[model samples]
Target: MAELWKSLPSWVRNIVVPVLVLVLAWNLVWFVVGVVSSLLGLLIKGLVVVGLAAAVVVLVKKAAKS
Candidate 1:
């Protein structure tokens, strides 16, 4: 194993390191965007549900008072 590692060319190592780093950075960015968008969607849906529930309660109270 040590010999295999030792035999790897310096040029290959230099190229591979930057390529791997870019791939990792891209994946991290993708994950963050996915998480943020999903959270935003959930928040919007929750707000809509809460608004509808409040409207229903208001209508029911008004009907009962009449």
Candidate 2:
């Protein structure tokens, strides 16, 4: 791998390596953002479902008392 890198021209090593590194870093950040956003969405959906379930239970109890 060292030998292969050595064979490449200086300009490619300088420019392409930095660009590739920046792309990898950018992708990593987006990956984390995507994961966080997905988890947040799931949490919101779960909360909504729970809220609906609680509402139904309360209505059922009120009807039973009547």
Q: Find the candidate with the highest TM-score and give its number.
A: 2
CA lDDT of each prediction against the hidden true structure: 0.93, 0.99
lDDT of 2: 0.99
**Candidate 1 segments whose C-alpha is farther than 4 A from its true place:** 1-8
The clash count of every prediction, one per candidate, is: 0, 0
TM agreement with the true structure for every prediction:
0.78, 0.87
Off by over 4 Å in 2: none
Question: Clashes in model 1: which pairs?
Answer: none
- Model 1 TM-score is 0.78
